[model samples]
Target chain A: MISSKWVVLVIYAMEDGPVRYGEFSRRIEGISKKMLTQTLRQLERDGLIERDIHPTVPPAVEYRLTALGESLLPFMRQLKTWAAANLPLVEAARTRFDAQSLAE
Target chain B: MISSKWVVLVIYAMEDGPVRYGEFSRRIEGISKKMLTQTLRQLERDGLIERDIHPTVPPAVEYRLTALGESLLPFMRQLKTWAAANLPLVEAARTRFDAQSLAE
Candidate 1:
């Protein structure tokens, strides 16, 4: 579940508060409807998120992170912070690697 | 590099100290030689690992984690610890979800 690239994206999208399905699609750019549905189901099944249905003319569905999921936020945030800070270094390394590879 | 499953395995294998290529092949089960080589190259290019070659009749080579890589250890370890502690909960949730899906 953690290995899925979409997992982190989806988790972060919901970091602020409960989110609707449509909102998730909009917030997480480049996610297909099928992938979003699948990711949400997987997260729910993993007990990381909870899906709630509100009674209305058309039942509204919202997803929020569970306590278990909330517990993961710090770790994910740390990784994200590290990535944000170090991405430039990675890009520079990639450029050098590609250049050397071409030279060889 | 972080998304690649083999990356973590290789990093952990080298966690204790420097490890030979052949030893990595042995320690990380089911990793193809090609995949291992590619992963190591990527890690080295990302500056997360250093490859050292020793002069010998049949030269010796070993891979070790770099400072940046060492910095990532705590975060990885925390995730590993969380996974170890919560895996059973996830498994239980999966079983429940599967059964519920079957019933539906």
Candidate 2:
């Protein structure tokens, strides 16, 4: 569930604190309403996030990380760090591999 | 690419030493040949694995982690560790969420 690219961005948005549905839509650019809803539902089902429904005019919903989700944050951050640090090398390798494939 | 489930299993298979294609197909049960080939090619292009071909009557091909890939092993292992440790909680949370949903 967490492996999805949307999952990563959603989790990152929740890093600070609880985020309402509207706020999530705003914070994560390029995510359609359908995708955001689906991601949130999946995270909630996985027990990585809690969905709070406020008893208001329209029942405002907010999402926050559970303890399990919070624990996963550090590891996810590490993966992000690795990606940022090594992307150049990875790109270079891809270029070389493509060139070699063409030669062969 | 790293998020692919096949990628994780493939990396794990190469942890001890270089692994032959047949060995990988055997080690990771249920992974189709097409998937294995695709995963290997992707890893090769990303510079995370080295595909070594040895000259013989029938060319022997092996796959092993590159230095950059080795660096990523620890972080990947940590993710595995976290999953192993917290799976029960996640499962339990899911059950609870499901039960509550049923009532509502």
Candidate 3:
């Protein structure tokens, strides 16, 4: 199964168009090389991305989101928007929940 | 930040309405008691759910999704639908990718 967070991150990161492996590595910060490789492979396996290898001196490679992958963006974007807008509400709730429990 | 998978699962599982702690454990097959509690707390803190405690011999508690949480269902359902429909394609891609690596 796909790691949903990485799946969303990679797909959203590649939203523009094709990106080479090194470029993807550069774009998403804090992703370990192993995790990045694994996430890419899994996304490829899931048909969310197409990895194209060009036959060159060292074989250049690139990645892009597939139609299936693009299909997820609208929903992902909406969630991102919702989260951003409601963060303060969520934080306030956490504060209240903690204080209530502390008093009990 | 939310643990997206559990957030989705718990929200979807509670789509019906309010549910008690013990019942939530029963409904979600693999969630441990500790994990269930933690996930619930996080969701509550996020203001996605309202947890109500009734006064009784012992306190009875129940959970229900808030309007903000229900607002996400449309997008979630679409992704779920897309995933279900394209699962075969993803499986095929994985098999081909694996076979390709093995052959190389």
lDDT of 3 by residue, A1-104 (tens): 54456666778888889988888767887888888898898888778899899998799899999887887788668767877887787788879988988999
What is the DockQ score of candidate 2, to 2 decimals?
A: 0.71
True contacts kept of each: 0.56, 0.80, 0.60
Candidate order (DockQ)? 2, 1, 3
**DockQ-better candidate, 1 vs 2:** 2
Candidate 3: TM-score, chain B only: 0.77
Question: In candidate 1, which residue pairs clash?
Answer: none
DockQ of all predictions against the true structure, Cα-based: 0.61, 0.71, 0.55
| Strongest candidate by TM-score | 2
TM-score for each of the candidates: 0.86, 0.88, 0.80
Q: Deviation in angstroms for A6 in model 1?
A: 2.3
Expressed as tens digits, the lDDT of each residue in B1-104 for candidate 3 is: 55555666788887878888788877877888888888888888777888899897699998998887777677667767877888888888889888998999
Each model's total of backbone clashes: 0, 0, 0
Task: Please report, as a residue range, the 10-residue window in candidate 2 chain A with the lowest summed lDDT.
Answer: A1-10
Give a tens-digit lDDT track for model 2, residues B5-91.
788889988988899888998899889999999999999999999998989769999999999889888976887888789889888
After TM-score superposition, what is the CA distance of residue B16 in candidate 1 from its true location, in Å?
2.5
Off by over 4 Å in 3: A95-104, B101-104
lDDT of 2: 0.88
